[model samples]
Target: MTTDRVNGIARAWWKEAVAYQIYPRSFMDGNGDGIGDLAGITARLDHLSDLGVDVIWLSPHYDSPDRDNGYDIRDYRAVSEKFGSMEEFDALLAGLHARGMKLLVDLVVNHTSDQHAWFAESRASRDAQKRDWYIWADPAPGGGPPNDWPSFFSTPAWSWDEATGQYYLHLFAPEQPDLNWENPAVRGAVWDLMRFWLDKGVDGFRMDVIPFISKTPGFPPIPEGGTPQKHYAEGPHLHDYLREMRTEVLSQYDVMTVGEGNGLDQAQMRRMVDARRGELDMIFQFDVVEFDRGEGGWPRDWTLPEFKAIFARQAASMDAHGWTTVYLANHDTTRPVSRYGDDAPGWRVPSAKALMTLLLTQVGTPFLYQGDEIGMTNFPFTAIAQFDDIAVRNAWARAQKAGTADEAQFLARLNRTSRDHTRTPMQWDGGPGAGFTSGQPWLVINPNAEAVNVAADRADPKGIYDWTRAMIALRHAEPALVYGGYRDLAPNHPALFAYAREIGEGGLCVVLNMAREPQRFALPRAAEPVMASGADLEGREIRLDGWGACICRWS
Candidate 1:
């Protein structure tokens, strides 16, 4: 019933592969510089190899002004001078491939930094050669934005440029203007940029904000206070653009393509990832990641059932569609340990491992963010000025300007929940600079770095790192954990989360206690525990301790 025991099954490398996502700026700095670089990543390739990951998904390290933390790419064809030189990047790619590992570079083509050469030239004059390379429009006769679209980061989505006497669209931040995908020349340029990286031996691309590429033509205005995203998020021409990209660039190589479909529902997601659809190989859904965000009219109350329902829906959809991608934490979300589990009482390790157990057991490729294996928690930011994320600052300013009764409280929550919390430096060790840098870090390392770090966890056999390794190994060793069919188990178990994955002649069951209190449940008579978050299972009935999880194989 193990993977080795199965017969006549076709295995894809990525299907069985585990991936580690590295936020380059915070991963590790080798030159005593405050920021991490390509050389720093090269130096840590050994660590990634030891962790048994098959691919390293490096977030945007392209040339940028650090606006939106490199999501605002200025130069797609070259590495940022701040990070390192082209030679360093080439060496890093070569090193990864030499070790039999693959690399996935971030593709931020949905938008570009205003400082990009293309944007600069496009904005120089009304009739510039590249004028239509970016979305620009004349202001309404009333001397205001052409539409009533609100930005994702809390401002008017259109920014008026006095020099050009026109308005440009920016979905996220003013510094990142939306690219005009409607222009064939612009699309061809993006394709050329992609080809540039592909020629450099990059195995694949993790397309950022891919759903926003195609907007509704005519710049229709949403009603005031309405969700502008409904009209623009997954616009009409999205499939056309994606299909074109597939034919021109993606299909040219045997590379994996995962699109970040931010606001897609189940039906829409199916159309995006279905093999017959010809859009993308997979998509990163935000439903599960957005669980902690409060619902309308009741923003602060945390609802466990709502979270569970969202997870169930997503898992069911993936199972129905035959493929998907799973992730608990990423560079743009708060650490799973602090957000989903009990970050108090130092129970981070068990909780982190438990969440991983729950996620990886699902029917999808699992993405492990850097430092998650060692139980990294969110970094605390005391002041708004210290926050580097535009979204956080904008939200804080909006709350303050509204003169809300709990303005300070709102800011505090934003600080704790913001993506900036996860962008802090990795906790490598208790040594100076937490072993992430020889100099000051780009952002402060978590205060708990002394207790929870790679070095200490690597030394502890029963640590979170070891637990994650075991879980990953299980995924590789068991057929049910890899190519199996998923079915939710004990849906009404309340404190216990469980699911079953069945592969041809074998099956495996995963169980997790999402709460801090111990829970007892009767396991299927044919099941036997193969791995667990803690050393003891407590009883034959499968009693899970606080924040504990286990995997069982059934014959």
Candidate 2:
């Protein structure tokens, strides 16, 4: 029943499936070593199965220096000792498959840890065999970095190598040296490593910062007052390289491939997911998430019309054959309830349920981050030392050095928008360390865990967990919800977000109150209620409480 084709779209399992991401270091602690491991994940398989998600996009667990929370890869094939051994990883993979769930391993080939053997050899000598494996350039005229390019971490992208007499480009932290995708050997290495995982039976790959793989020739300088990321994103050889990957690796397996598209536009993103182009299955564009983000990573207020326009524009970009992804939170983004829905004391539960309704009913492959089902809110971070994300730490250091660091102001922004909020331990029960670890957790657990743990949520009949589970069930059963044509029913409504999804003759209508005030929305026609968070119907108008969401069928 879950495999039926709808709206004449291609019958791809990935299209119909729902994916959940697991950030390993915070998911669960198996060895009681204060960190999450594969064994703990295997033990928690039943929790995911019960949630009705079809795919699991596991975050990076490969061996690393923990510089960027496993994004810096030391070894592509070896599972990190902190996470577990190779045997435990295999067991965890088996556990997911045994429960009818697929695995999407994080592929962070945009860069590798400086400790990686290839980088070591590359940095050894100018004439080394692997010297070209990474992007390296001579120093500028005055003997500084090759160019003025800035990293995503807010540092210089070029790091000087004293011993090698040159600079290597790192679009991220210096520890993560960018791989030269232009080099055939590097591309071959990536393909081989992918095959290594595929041969192990992993279902797919969630490519990390994949669009940054190609860089413009000549190492051009970024324009002053211009976006730094724009200079390197969607380079000349991006599609050509993706085509090569499709032919060399992805074509051989029945696996899903989604790239992290950080700096791409709508047209560029559309090209990546177009099946006929044979580049990738889909790419994650950040328009919806970044829409509310202001300059320098600050939080900003956004209007409902603007938000609707973003989704409508994104949905319109995909044709009947093309597909996109729907997600509000991931390892890099803030919590959905905190960002999109109200997370206040009294409104948290209803708002979380409403956001889940929006996520699951959307026309794309939906991905839920860890703790999203239980309505986990952001951590009340008071100091910079509590942050585990390198980006935050780097930004804070830069602020302090520039004499612009205001303690209260920075904390406010950090509490509102830091990625560390999503990296906290998954709350299993109302116990110490949120029952995620018997010993001390690597990061402090959120204090609200006692009230927001999975055990507590699942125990309540009207909790967020049940609402999310029911929504997932409905999406899995209804073909229209999976591949339906989307229409913004109230495009100009200030506070009411109403849209209809149609597939052939049958479809569903979704109405959401995005503000704190109650909203009365008029339906285009009469409808039968399917499910709702907190909504009431009076005659031709549906009244929704603050952050209320409802789904219905055409009468």
Candidate 3:
């Protein structure tokens, strides 16, 4: 592995590499089980390797109940039988490594499934040996939850245990009980499980809700109208826990670590990922991805300047130190084309390419969700019954129980912001099941799979997938795109987003037309066009034809 030292800071492969996330359950299915498995992933490794993503972030496939689509892990060291066996998982890992790609398994240490051995023993009785492994508290004076904390699934964060006669804290679904990080034994167990994978030669981790592992000292009650996340996010001992994790497990290997920094501001983000801090290599900040999120799972409108400013601020935050992820969508988000790009008939291809161009040209490491490269759009969910995401189901149930649910309006929200939009099966071909499976898919395939499958996309040289492949190649070929300073040329432009990435005397200028109307941008300096999609240039003046993008090289 080659390491670049710029400004006395070490930049490793992850800094310059593009990462692709594989939501295993929805990616591909082998053995015709209607569920994707390790074997499925191994069989499809070529798709990712050909796409040129150096890292593959595989979501949880551990022994899980599938309650939260595999986020509720039942065992730390075992693969879910539904997904595959341990041997099959080993094959998948070897496949990734063999393809010159590293695997970052989802590290969901903040909580474990209620069925996990530790949680089972913890909930068996108050005097169980593992009783302290999870957060357990007696009912409050009012006979309710221990505190006013709320679950991420839109319910109280506590669930009463009949056998133990106590309420256990669960930041997500009740099936997922948050572990007690204050306990030394729990920390030791976590470190051991991490090493279990490291010893097996897996790359690193995409830590899920890592900051939420630590809690406020006293578990204070929230003030009126205050959000629950504000009280529990980035708790007092977060850095201590992270540093201990680094010392005990992470620093031993040359692996990458990216934490989900959901509620963290830019400064807090820097504090978590700054190399000097030794906490993490990078963190995913939601400032860019959550712009469309609104109250009660509804979608909100956002302006281009607002969107551009959020990204610029994120880039600025990492300018001096630390690293951040550049992504438009993930398993937890709506499809990027539907959310950020023009996914309509003629504009879909260009807009998808343009968005990817923006991602690859950014200074931070870029991450691509499974089907985003093919310009996948949101699914038209007509009924709530079709939704499989726990977050969406819980939110809808809560609204219905409160008698405030408008079926039509809520369905619209589900269509716009629900995670199911991105959880659909990958479109490998236009055939039955989109070539994902011979049997029925676990989830509904997008209706436009026939028109947007990879088979069709790869056939067209200018299609989104090929454009993404070429962009990844460009990013790898140009060191400036990864290590350069970012400067926005049209920060206030309504339809144009132009930025220059400069390092030393060589640099690349990226121009993106973010609208359907054609736009013209004046380059800050003379440069020759290197790549373009739906764009043309004449004498340092670029004319972007409706959702077009262009990359210019300068030396």
Q: Candidate 3: lDDT of 122?
A: 85
Candidate 2 Cα errors over 4 Å, as ranges = 1-5
Write candidate 3's Cα lDDT for 103-159 as tens digits.
Answer: 999999999998899987887878999999999899998798887788999889999
TM-score of each: 0.94, 0.98, 0.98
Deviation (Å) of 105 in candidate 1: 0.7
Q: Spell out the clash pairs found in candidate 3.
A: none
Worst ten in a row by lDDT for model 1:
1-10
Model 1 per-residue lDDT tens digits across residues 1-555:
123323233455666778889999899897888898889899988888887788899999888987788889888877888789999999999999999899999989888999999999999999999999999998898899997788888888999999989999999899999999999999999899999999889989899988889988897777565555456767889999989989999888878788886767777777888766677877888877766566531225465666667767776675333457888889888888888887776587788888878767776788999988888888776667777788877776786788763746765676557787788888889988999999978787778888889999999988888778777878888767767776677776667787788866478878888888888777665667788775244344787788888777774
- Sort the predicted structures by lDDT, highest score first: 2, 3, 1
Model 1's lDDT to the true fold?
Answer: 0.81
Strongest candidate by lDDT: 2
Candidate 1 at residue 416, lDDT? Answer: 57
lDDT tens digits, residue span 1-555, model 2? 244456877778998899999999999999999999999999999999999999999999899998999999999999999999999999998999999999999999999999999999999999999999999999898889888888989799999999989999999999999999999999999999999999999999999988889999998877777687667888999999999999999999999999877888878888888989999898787888888888877889888899888878877888866788999999887888888888898899988988899899887889999999999999988888898899988998999999999988989998988889899999999988888999989998998998999999999999999999999999998888878999999888998888989986679999999888988888888888888778976666888989888888887
By summed lDDT, which 10 consecutive residues of candidate 3 come out lowest?
1-10
Q: Native-vs-model 2 lDDT?
A: 0.90
